[model samples]
Target: MTSAIPRITRRLVALLCLVAAPAAFADIVIGQVAPFTGPQAVTGKAMRAGAKLWLDEVNARGGIRGQKIKYVFRDDAQKPEETVRLVKEMIEQENPAAMIGTVGTSNLEALKQDGVLEKTRVSMFGAVSGATSIITARNMYPVKASYREEVERLFKQLGEMGRTKVGVVYQDDGLGRDALAGAQASAKTYGITLVAQSGYARNTTEVSNAVAEMVKQAPDVIFLAATTAAAIEFTSRYQAAGGRAGLFGMSIIDVQALLTKLGPDRARGFAFSVVLPTDDRQDREVVREYLRLRQNSKDTELSSRSLEGFIAARALTKAIERTASPTAANITETMDRGFETDVGGHRLTFGKGQTPSRYVDFAVLGNGGRLVR
Candidate 1:
């Protein structure tokens, strides 16, 4: 009987040890919600490619803290309602350590409802700048230059060119409104007047009428604040209407597809603020690495949209690496410490009260649809 009792005790102890052993920690999951299947699908696709490239590289190099990163993409369809639902679902089910690469102002704004960042305590980074509200959130970080900063820089360049009177055309959405507001405010500081301001819906395709209306004003410069597709259509029609005013576009329009669609003759002399460094082979180590990655990628023709995604992912990765743990509060604290990273030759910094990407790059559409900085 004593021998049987001793064997039973040993078996029970072994079972308890097995039950108490810690489970292996899985890879860190980063959730990305963007307009993957809507009007901005091109941008979404580019962003996804860039992110994937970065993730592949990171994994190849043994991911941060010896843990792999798993990026889960959610399609918001560029709709505010869908964005809200998708974000909620991701937070509840996946419980990702952080969220990155949310595109568009409306979608970002929708994600801001009910102090979601504070409640979930998840770090959100890499929002394509549209509204200042997103970056202002303590927990949210922006990887791109703000529309306000871009507009201010454009206005400064216009002022230098002696082009004072500017006309503005924007979609009547949160993005356009924020850009127009920024332009208007910056114009005041530069002693420039926005001669005409026109608004249109995103669903509207024919902007010839709007172009004509803007041309009638005869402003020295036209500031376009619309999506890439609308910007292309508007620019084509505006030029076709024989409007000679210099055209300036925001980051939203600073895409390769628009330049390709408008062609060199139409796109020439067109200037826009670029949040990321263009595909300049001689820029920085980061750009070189990015190009190398793209060359190895099956998909050629890497666009600025994808570059934005790559920048965002890198920023998030840096934050995660610096963080003590994958917890939201620790990640936010690490980001708030203002670590610097090189996005191509451009420098990006994040901290409290400091907007990301203080310096903005200006690109001119040159011959052969090339972007010259």
Candidate 2:
């Protein structure tokens, strides 16, 4: 009962507190459209908490240039069409100065295809996708390393450890397609054999066939390029079938959530590639600050997704600080003019010919569900 309380608080705060700007309060407004209720809800919730924590802190300190920021978040339920609709509605009604924390490669692609970002000219930061389409889309800036980078890094490590026979489990969406391509490329580069591969439907955990396929291959390692829910389901089902492949996943797997659901026994030894420095990096001022704020808040768990949200918020705030009178156009222009800044120790630079940040760390689930470097 007590554990459920924090979950309820997070849900309420995510849905109500940032749903829309009060009509009376007028100031800086930023909006987001993401999955709040669906398979991806866990990712959405962590992102909301991390971004909101920084934004709330900014407001508590009297806001930027004495103007309070209004963060408006809407739910898309992990549907691409709904993402297009809700983002359009938010832009028309709220007139957000910018956008932040958009999730999913397909959702971002839907927005791009509909010209929502280009037409509205609102700069969006911290898009939770490493898909090439999103990275190249005009007015969309990604803060993390590309999915290709994450896959290649993992493959390189596997190659070093002489784990050459590998299989893949990915979603059949833009995110999955991008990652699968990366996996193929990385396998070729690392001299790892692509023994077998399987893909599940988007936004669903129906991975029985996929799991069966992987079990048959019995590769030395299986790379999971999937969402959190799908990853959890696959891990549970695969292990139950007596499959013994070394489970490795991309950053979207949400290590903290995995620990909670699968427990230490089943979840142990699974490795993950994280885009940000792990929580133990006390050397990073941003990591320290995030830890402090999380400990002080009602949020139940801390994960890379949450840290990603906070970092995205910090980057957007830095741009807002430089603009004369923050608006969609000026913020877009300010960010387009080669925006670069350091969030504590992690550095991000954006402009023409700029590659996304290339920082990734690997960790494995140790005893008691803690990450071991």
Candidate 3:
């Protein structure tokens, strides 16, 4: 009787362990490498927050296919070399099912230098860069408007407003070069003259010379293809020097960051293109959902950057759900086979269009740092 009792107790313990074990099924790991501790930290933080929001909701709802999703990220500190190393490390150790929201044009170029994605067969979704090189890559699927499209839109608006003379300030790197080319092409399309152009070194904000040059030209508007910090500096200096040209910037500029640094009074009228709807756009279902989730969480900062991250996660989540088996190849194949999802009235399509998302809007800093459409 004692032996029988011990056997029954052992069987009950085994059953409980099987029921309670969290790791019975492997997690679907996704990797991200972005600048978390460098000049681009502000953008990286928002991207992380946005992606985590949707992913948390998914995990709370029992995840996809009964397997929880695990997000693994590393800070590249805005260095291209570090980006490569960290991505390689994550693949070898974590074996991420896919990569999401890797930031920077130079970093993407570095990854492409050695055919990293091609050799590894890992597909990256929602890269933060709009450079032609990164967007046109074989395995990369972008979820935002390209720099060229952004420039064209800006120029088209300029043409409508009769602002013909335009100056371009670009970073002397892959990102800026790509945008400059786009700006040049858009200039021709919109009948705007390339009055004055200047290049600043990457990862640095020495824009005084560029400011002086642009102000000297006194163009109708200045198209900034620079980073957030650079944009703020250029705006502040340009305005202080009595330069009255409207400052139009790429989507890379974070409106929140600009307002924080320059304040509402200084930031007012500084316009920039946004690849996604602004946080205040509650008319869209995705915006409302994102705002609700953000309010429920500890994240307090709301900007287009974070919103973009949420949309990117939503797209990746849909891809994962659609795949019968969540391997890198399976996810990529599923996305390649004409994948599209309605993210609360905003549509993101892959394999059916030249770009994944055709949504682009513009906003300017209004009173008290508010985004005015």
Among all windows of ten consecutive residues in candidate 3, which has the lowest summed lDDT?
350-359
Candidate 2, residue 217: Cα displacement in angstroms equals: 0.9
Please give the distance, in angstroms, between residue 276's alpha carbon in candidate 2 and its true position after superposition.
Answer: 0.9
Each prediction's whole-model lDDT (CA): 0.78, 0.88, 0.86
Q: Tens-digit lDDT track for model 3 on 229-284?
A: 88888898998999999889899888788888888899889998988877788899
Among residues 3 or more apart in sequence or in different chains, the pairs in candidate 3 whose N, CA or C atoms overlap within 3 Å are: none
TM-score of 1: 0.89
- Model 2: per-residue Cα lDDT over 154-272, one tens digit each: 99999999999999999999999999999999999999998988999999999999899999989999999999999999999999999999999999888888888999989999999
Q: Candidate 1: how large is its RMSD?
A: 3.6
Which prediction has the highest lDDT against the true structure? 2
Q: For residues 199-277, could you state the per-residue lDDT of candidate 1 as single tens digits?
A: 8786355577679888899999889888877888888888878898888888776457876786677788888887766
TM-score of each: 0.89, 0.92, 0.92
lDDT-superior candidate, 2 or 3: 2
